[model samples]
Target: MTYFILQFLNGLQIGAIYALVALGYTMVYGIIKLINFAHGEIMMTAAYFIYFFMTLLDLPYFLAVILAIVFSVVLGVLIERIAYRRLRNASRLSALITAIAVSLFLQTLYAILFTPDPRAFPLTASSFPVLEIGEITLSSWTLITIVVAVIVMILLQLFVTRHKAGKAMLVVSEDLKGAYLMGIKVDRIVSMTFAIGSALAAIAAALYIVSYPQITPYMGALPGIKAFIAAVLGGIGLIPGAMLGGFLLGLVETMTRAYIPSSVAQLSEGIVFVILILVLLLKPAGLLGKSEREKV
Candidate 1:
């Protein structure tokens, strides 16, 4: 029971990270209809920024975190402006290729500057006091992560449903042309989407380092991919769907690794892919997604 509880906590922590990244994927896809494949690289860049600020600049942890997030937001905006904006009216294939190119460019740049070696970041003490519940012990960090994720989700929900800017974003997502005609600044909204997504990725990266300090240029790829999968599983353009998908994916993956045989564990990724395919075939719009019917 204790072991089970521990694994559950671990899954929750990982799910929190996935939710953060997946939200980025879902949001961008919702408004722009682009995957933003380079998003993982944005996360990698943020992690590296945190590393540099903490180790080289010797900044305090909070300051480093803030700076890293700021840098990531700027980078995301620049990527959208330089690569995506130009391709806005272009074919989806062209935009996808651009996204892939951006991903490759960032990876290459990081490799050159940070080297291919995995560097470990400094882990500060866990944020929460440990609590013992019968045979199960829960760490403060895990609780904090879950709580924070929930709070963020609530705030985001309110923003989208109630806030003017968020409603504008929704309008843009629903009908870009109509929204533009209605005096909504489509470009600014799209940029805001990128900024928010990147900021979330930064937060995820920072929290991830707390548990797993090792940082590498390619580290973001797997998590980013998984988060993308989560977005799809939950209903790609839906914000709440992304969060639900992330936690479910995390829980499923962690449980499989814990109980399944080592051979099966090795094939867990493949299983996830299969699940993704099945989900697509069964419900193209995803679990919570609504199918957008085209009007002639």
Candidate 2:
């Protein structure tokens, strides 16, 4: 029972990080209908920014986080304006290829700059207090991560539901032409969406690095892929669904890792895709997504 509880807490901690990154995936898909494969690269970029800020500049943690967020937001907007905006009306395949190109570009740039060497993350490497519940123990950072994930999700929900800019986003998401007809600034809103998503990725990168403490150019790829899967599981465009999917994916992956045979433990990540396949077969619209009937 204690072991089970500990695993559950671990799942939640990992899931929170997934939730943060998944939200970025969902939001971008919601607004632009583009996958933005480079989204993960942006997270990787943010992690590098944090690493430099902390290691070279010796800035405070919070300040480093803020700077990373700023850089990510700017980079996201730039990517949208330069790479994706012109291709919005083009074939989906075209946009997808471009996204891949952008991702490779970032990866190559980082490889040249950082040389693919994994550097230790300074924060969360030192000893921190651990919390004990019954016989189960949890890291303080894990608890902080869970709380932070919940708070960020709640704030995001409120922003989308209650704020004026958010409503404009909703309108644009529902119908781009309708939003333009209704006098909403479609382009600006799209840019805002990218900025917001990128900022969230930045935050996710920060939280994730603390737990894993190892940074490299390719670090964000797996998490980014998993987060995209989570978003799809929960309904790609739905904010609440992204959160739910993230947590669920985290729990499932953790459980698989703990319970699977040692010889096959290396295949834990593969199980996630298997689960995705089952979910898609059972619920084509996703757990939270609605099925649409195309007009013939």
Candidate 3:
């Protein structure tokens, strides 16, 4: 039981990071109906920004984080304006392919510039003090991660329901033409969505480095994919769903590794995909998602 509780707590920490990233994925999708596959790459770029600010420029840690997040926000907006804007009226296939192209471009560009080797992240778990409770021991980073995620979730909910700009986002998400007709400045709202989402990704990248510490050009791929799965599992367009999905995915992965046979433990990743498949087959609309029909 003690062992189980430890794993559960560990899972919550992992889930918090996943939830942050998944929120970005879902937010972008909710507003623009685009998957923004480059989101993981955006996160990777932010991580690199932190590396450059800290290692190369010798800036303070919190300062580096703020600047990195700002840069990520700008990068996201630029991508939307340059890459995805024109494709708004195009077929979904076109937008999807462009998103994939953008993702590849970022990865390749990073690889060429930074090399394919992994570098040690400056701010790691060792940087934090550990906290022990009874027989269970955990890092301060774990508590911080969970607290941050919960705070973010609450703030996001409030923003969406109460803030004027957030209400504009909701309107645009529901009916773009209608919102525009009502003078909502749909383009601005879309950019805001990307900016907000990218900021969340930056935060996730910072938190993730503390746990994993290894930074590579391709570091964001696995986590990005998992977060996307989480978004889909929780209902891609629903904020609460993303949080739920992230926590569920994290628990499932941790528990599988802990309880499953050692020989087959390597299949834990595959089991995640299986969960995605099951979610799709069993509840295509997702746990918190409502089904909608469109006239074609």
Model 3 Cα lDDT, one tens digit per residue, 28-107: 89878888899999899999999889999999878998999999999999999999999999999999999999999999
Better of 1 and 2 by lDDT: 2
Model 1 earns a TM-score of 0.95
Candidate 3: stretches off by over 4 Å = none
lDDT of 2: 0.91
lDDT, residue 292, candidate 2: 89
**TM-score of every model?**
0.95, 0.98, 0.98
Q: What residue runs in model 2 are displaced by over 4 Å at the alpha carbon?
A: none
- Candidate 2 lDDT tens digits, 1-296: 88888899889988998999999889889888999899999999999999999999999988999999999999999999999999999999999999999999999899999999999998882356888877777788888888988998899999999999998988888888889999999999999999999999999998899999999999988898999999999998888898999999999999999989999887886988997898889996789999889656
The all-Cα superposition gives candidate 3 an RMSD in Å to the true structure of 1.0
Candidate 1 lDDT, 98-140, residue by residue in tens: 9999998999889998798999888642554787879877777
CA-RMSD of model 1: 1.6
lDDT of 2 at 47: 98
lDDT of 2 at 123: 84
